[model samples]
Target chain A: MIAENYSLTGKQILHFETFGFLVRRNVFSAEEVAKINGEFDRRRASILAEIDPEEKRTFTQWPTRNPENPFTASLLDDPRIYVPSEQLVGEDSIPIQSHCNSYGKSSGWHVDTFDRRLCVIKNILYLQPTTADRGALRVIPGSHRSPLSEDLRNMDLYGFHDDTSPFLNASGMRGEDIPCYIFESEPGDVITFNELTWHAAFGGYKDRRSLSYNFFTNPKADDEIESMKKIVEHTPANTQGLGTVGLEYHPNWLENADNNPRRARWINWLEKWGFTDVLNN
Target chain B: MSMLTEQQITFFNTFGFIILRKVFSDEELAIMDDEFETSLKTIQGERPDNEVPKHFNWSNLGPETPFLSLLPEDPRICETAEQLFGEHVIAVSSNSNRRVGNTHWHTDQSHPHSYGLKFAAYLQPLNSDNGAFRVIPGSHKQPFNDKLKHIEMHSSEITVPYYSCDSAPGDIVIFNFATWHSSFGGSTNRRMCTIDFYKNPETPEEVEGTYDQVIVDEKVYAKLRAYGSGFHPHWLANPQNSPRRQRWIDWLRKYGFVKSEEA
Candidate 1:
């Protein structure tokens, strides 16, 4: 059952507004983490067996439409994630992307997006303990705001200039040496961050396991609706073969909605956007 | 009389760009060709990091060398800029580029205004079949601009009808900073140079807007040792009598776009 008073405190809200991210320590219980890890591990093993290990691939939107694991499916209504998401964005926010990642190499610093209009926040859960050397998330606080965001946005972070130079470094410093808050975590700790906030992982394990749920503010204006449509069009088919059929979400998650009014609001919006036909199909 | 005609001005306003045929004389064109070669060697010689990409570029190429220094104040350039941007215009930055392969469609800056523009001249002939400059006209405007930009970012195959700016050596291409542009087919050694200019701010808000853009432009230089001052030392040190250039330099220095020590 959802917690009775599942809400973020005023101080936590202020912290998120100031830094563009928050860490909710031990949001998932040990038992919950174990169950989530077990489900993902079985899926990862099956995925790995089907692919060449030498190719070193990663899977996104894992176990989303899957119905075999009831515990993972229940995350949709989890008070810990759902409550904080509602507090941060709004009741109208809906999950747009999900992933269970095994990265091939350390990722360079980048914002989830360049546009300022779209508001997509990602909630990441680490299934294993993580450190900087083991590829914990690192962020530059308040980087999502203007001036700082503007500066970072123009740089050749991915080396279009062949500079290979670390971005946002006033003086020459290695990308790892730039000042940042490392999200060192034990299993079950949840980190939620604005998609626009600059983040990177350095020196991570090849099999480093993490799950992410991306949620976005519901489109209200004409421009926001267009932006949302573009995001949906660009999104590839998920593991459940949901979006591939159309912009329709995972059919299984829709079927499980039943009497949940909160999920119904999102479903209504999706149907308006031509995402409902796949459910019947 | 203005260097550019009224129809040319209207075309520029509508499409966010215009190509001025033979803007430079044969002598000036030859000097530019020699200076570009010199600049390539100069940048390579001054490179502090070998890891930096071999396709080199350095800003404010104007004051660094003589023939290039005369470009900003040249009547052909200054008069046309004044016509569009108003009486108080500022030369922001100038640079040389040695390009490689294809550049996907994108705006240099996405700010929804005509505050800044770039005038580029390629050293060699180019066509759409050979890596010619391409642009989607009227893409600097709102709502639709954003939508087209979104497609440019998301999709690889660009199906929109785009104007290919096939050019010879003397042709000058001027475009708004927000205009969506790219080059499709090109060799690795395609050489080009551009001079950036911005409208002089009439209000504090406009001044701040200019400040924000300067910060964005300076991020490119933040990684290099030679670019320690953001602007080249020559850009700071070279004395100019024109109140227009001086006023702009003072504003940049005051706002920290120019290094304090260099100022």
Candidate 2:
């Protein structure tokens, strides 16, 4: 059994650093997963109700720091989340965002961000079992590093206009046929990857449920801080324009920060870096 | 003629492997299969009980099997190797195998500086459950290559992710030597042939890497000798008189792997 305050072992850290990702099986108990699933369903139902019937069915909600869902918000404080983030990034690393998504389409192969300066890690939890033929996450190992990363960027993997992607042109295979490691997962498995790693999903059913908890290793350099700013400024606008105009965190999240040392420390860092102002409110 | 497109080159560089479907026609596959079977029979006949060993292997380069011997120099194979490793690439060796059971995850070239490739053609239809070749893409590149060392030890567990190169008789699968690859769930006597090639050394480090590979190949050749097989005289003498083949022969001779008597 994993301890309550579990930290990543040296081997696990090496694996993540080397392969650009790591998987921890059964990190959460069935009871904990059920709680998370319950929160996701409740929030998803509310978000779906607001959308037009003919609009795309995908729904995403920023649930991490939402005061209305204290159980979901408290996940940032959970050791299973924080400890690995701290170990991989640093102790000063702060929770950046948490998203609950019910995906309606398959994701094309791409990295979360192209900004190599940003040291962000995303920990993903799928609410159901998935395989390669299902909706399992696939990654090209070590694509985040130099040379390979630059090579992929030059290929413009994301810029293909028609059916002819560079992957297809070169390998005589379709996008889904590109060689990659598929993260076949069970409900309690936590798969963590660097933001720069190339990943995709295919053949997923509509309303595929997943939760992503993202963390940013505290920016120490000027360029990294600038990258962070761009991320903070653009995230809300990119997420189908949801949430308050200028606020990254909910007001209740900021209000509760006073009572939580971990959240307070992160809030203070965000304020110092002037990132909290990006959302205006 | 250059056989690979720019996009295919980029894909191979990025993923460490690529598949070319129908590289050989059905008739060509049939002829090659016949040649391979005849060679296997020749080796089996020399054995004490006329029995082919599990995972039986023999050199593909011999005058007795004219078609199999010329595969390394075939334009489809040689030109593609040139496109990947430049015009100076040399055919290292070609061997046919009758494999059984499963082969575990490992790289052919593990040295950090060494670079090489293999062209694999399976003689039967295969898929994920039945001996399809599998690879961890991008694992040929460093940090990833070294990171996968643990796989060699815990191969059965195989925590790392991989792609299966499902193939048919006429398909060709090419992969970097540094890429971690393996096969599983194969029936007994799974027939396949492979031709190895190495990037011609242009630097001192690459030269050293070439020497390192020679050491590895020496061990393999010693095993082949025990199995009553070795490089054919026609192959050693380079009867085709190809300059690229000559360069490789010279290098092998310099390392004492090929001697005057053998030629």
Candidate 3:
């Protein structure tokens, strides 16, 4: 069992530093897991209400900071998640995106665009048991670090238009044939990985639920600041025209975390990025 | 005298691996078989289990077996290594394996420098139905290989066509360590062995990679502890030495991999 403070062990850090990903089994208590699932479903029903349950659908970047769903918002500051993020990126890091996916078919293999100047990571919390056959998160170990990782960034497999390319079809290789770690997860298990890591999902069910929080280092360098600008403007709907989430935090959710210094830092970071109008206030 | 043909080398470069037909003669095969059987006896005597161990390697067979030890020096092997790598190629490791079940598709290691390769010889005649080797062509190349990781992860769910190497006992299959390869439909008693070699490091990065591979990595050390002694004492004493072999051995000793009788 992880300690109460839940600092990463040296071996865990080594694995992450080498492999670009790590899994913490049973990071949440059973009750917390249930509450998290309840919060996700509660919010999911409100947003995807018009869509038929039978029809396949995917909606990303859902706001988890609803006052009624405090569990989801508190997850951002949870020691189990925050400690590792601090260790990976920097202590001054801020959570950038929170997204929940309901169901989707096989997603293509890709990385979430990496910046050479910054370290970005994604923390995934599955709401249900998932296996390799059922759209489990698959990652290539050490694919984010060096030689091969750069190759992945420049590959033209999917092509400019995301059209099917000859590289994939010529050999009859599918999304699953790629060598990677099949992260079969149960609810409450947390899988944290570098944003640059190559990953994909295949054969997902309709009700398969999971939440993701993307975090990046606080911008210091000029290139890093520019990269951060592009990230905030292009990703979240607040600063950017096309993307997910209008506000980084909900007013009710911010009320609960008003005194917390981490939350203050997060808000300050957002404001510095010209996202002042996005505050829930 | 028996070196890889131009076509064979092209095939290897294009497909990331190749199978040379009957690289070893029948007499050599018999000697290899004997040496292998004797090694199996020694290993079993050490660790007896009813069910075969999932996977275990017997390293440094050259020290234990007379003929097997000389395999790296064989004209066919030496010439091929020279052509592919350079005059400074070094044979680093030799080992036999008792394999079980499926080895999922994976590159051996992501090397920072030049490629390291494994020359494999299967003891039994095998086809795709019974533990034959398989590989994806061009998957070892930079951008092309990057996409293979995702495909390999989902191989069970997706039908990714791969080259199945159906072979007999005398054939030699050589492949880059970065190439994605796996054995499927293997029996509980599947037997195979490999002699690993690498091009001499010329650059600082390559030198560091060489050091990391032999001295720094724990996994590499495990294999070394089992099979990585300096050249066999007999070979050292009665050197049927070639300039090439001696240079390579000298390099290994220089790197502190080889232990002398004095030490």
Candidate 4:
């Protein structure tokens, strides 16, 4: 559980603004992290049993806001998560995406999106101890800003579009060897970054557990709304029969939203933006 | 001939640093290493037992070491500096150091308009966990450069993330003077040397800034004082008598960094 008086400091807010990322340690207690780990394992086991008898190197499914994982869903209401999210992205920011990942292989460097108008931040929780050589997230500080962001976009260092060639522009080094800040973390720590920041992971075990929560600043501008529409349209539905299959949000998540004022507001925003259309079709 | 390619220059401009692998051959490195050791011993004397780990340095491009004094005129070093800072760049100073563990994060030059570069040659193998140079890429530019000032203030711990420039004996790491950089987890007596160069001042403001820098910058002032007369007599005498060295000497004398009558 979060401490009663816990809140992000002004210095931390400035750090996030300056560096494009922030790390808060022990945001969740040991007991809370243990509960999260247990919930993650249960979800993973269910997915594995039904499909993919041979385990894949990575498995990602949305575990938040689901009726089966009410404890995890309530994280949206928890001040430890929402308070900082509000501070960074404004109080009206809404949840855009959630993922619980079981990663086995190294991830190459890439930003989540190049759409500047989207304005999203991701808060990630590792369910295990992570170090530089053990699957920690690495980020290029201030790479989220323009020109550098545009430059990295042009480099296509990770070969996101062309799987045939990778690390083409990595200055003769492997992805892991690229100079970056490795977010070495413990289970209770939360690492947050702008979605446009360049990030990667390397040297991880076969079952490195991570939970990610993405929040987007509520659209007020025309361009922002348009960007939101594009995001909603382009986001592929999770069809792996794991969590929220063939839908942008799970049905139980919407059902649970009615009771929570903050969740309801977020759900209302999603509905207004046509996020529910993916389920309708 | 220019030692740096267009792509390498671009990398330096974009990332605030670049490592040129094997810039010096093994034989060349052996000579440099020998000179560095001899000069350190000659100037600072033998290290005492249980000496407190600290960064030790003395003037490098001076008459005390004839071979090292001429390094500024070496085509590989000179041409690279020219490529980065233009043909008229000023050779600021050079130093050989026995560095201790964890030099904290900072820019050698913090002024927004400051245009200078440092070429560091570490004579020993180093990695992230062993005193390798680390930098936050692109931090030499505005906004990013200013944003990194916090690291300078809170430098005791490696709070911010950085890219480690793990290097070998013959490698050279060239970086912008404003780039935020540090080394961590190093042992005492990590052998290294550096040459600093600045872009030639064109405008009146730049000239005044350069003069002010010479007077106000602690490192530059310290270096000048350490050289006794601001330059070695042999170095001032232009022993090799190269026109390039003559030009630098003339610039130094004109700027009042050296006495005109000393030579």
Report the number of the highest-TM-score candidate: 2
DockQ of 3: 0.08
Worst 10 residues of 1 chain B by lDDT: B152-161
Summarize candidate 2's per-residue lDDT along A180-275 as a digit string, tens digits: 888898999999999888888877787788888988988879998788778777864665364321235778877764587888898887777665
Query: What's the distance in Å from true for residue A109, model 2?
Result: 1.5
What tens digits encode model 1's per-residue C-alpha lDDT throughout B41-133? 776666675333535565544454677765776787777888877777777666677777888778887344437888898888999778888
DockQ of 2: 0.53
Instruction: Flag clash pairs in model 1.
Output: A61-A98, A162-B53, B131-B185
Native contacts, share recovered per candidate: 0.00, 0.63, 0.00, 0.37
Residue A63's lDDT in candidate 3: 59
TM-score of chain A of 3: 0.87
- Report iRMS values in order: 18.9, 3.1, 10.5, 3.3
Share of the reference A-B contacts seen in candidate 2 = 0.63
**By TM-score: ranked, best first:** 2, 4, 3, 1
lDDT of 3: 0.70
lDDT of 1 by residue, A1-281 (tens): 65476688765665566557888888888998899888877766665665544544532335444564457666766777778888888778876555566555566677777766778888898888988788788876555665445545554343211135434233343556433567889988998999888788776666777877777888888888888777655443322443221122456777655768777776777677544542333
Models ranked on lDDT: 2, 4, 3, 1
For candidate 1, what TM-score does chain B get against the true chain B? 0.87
Q: Give the per-residue lDDT digits (tens) of candidate 3, residues B57-93.
A: 7664355677777787777787787777777788876
**DockQ by candidate, in order:** 0.01, 0.53, 0.08, 0.42
lDDT of 4 by residue, B35-57 (tens): 98777656544445534336656
* Candidate 2 lDDT, B18-70, residue by residue in tens: 99999999889989899988887777788889876666577878887788888
Give me the runs in candidate 3 sitting further than 4 Å from their true place.
A1-3, A51-56, A155-166, A236-248, A256-258, A276-281, B1-115, B121-190, B197-263
**Sliding window of 10 residues with minimal summed lDDT for model 2 chain B:** B150-159
The residue-by-residue lDDT of candidate 4 on A167-224, one tens digit each, is 4443455666556788988999999999989888877678788878889988889999
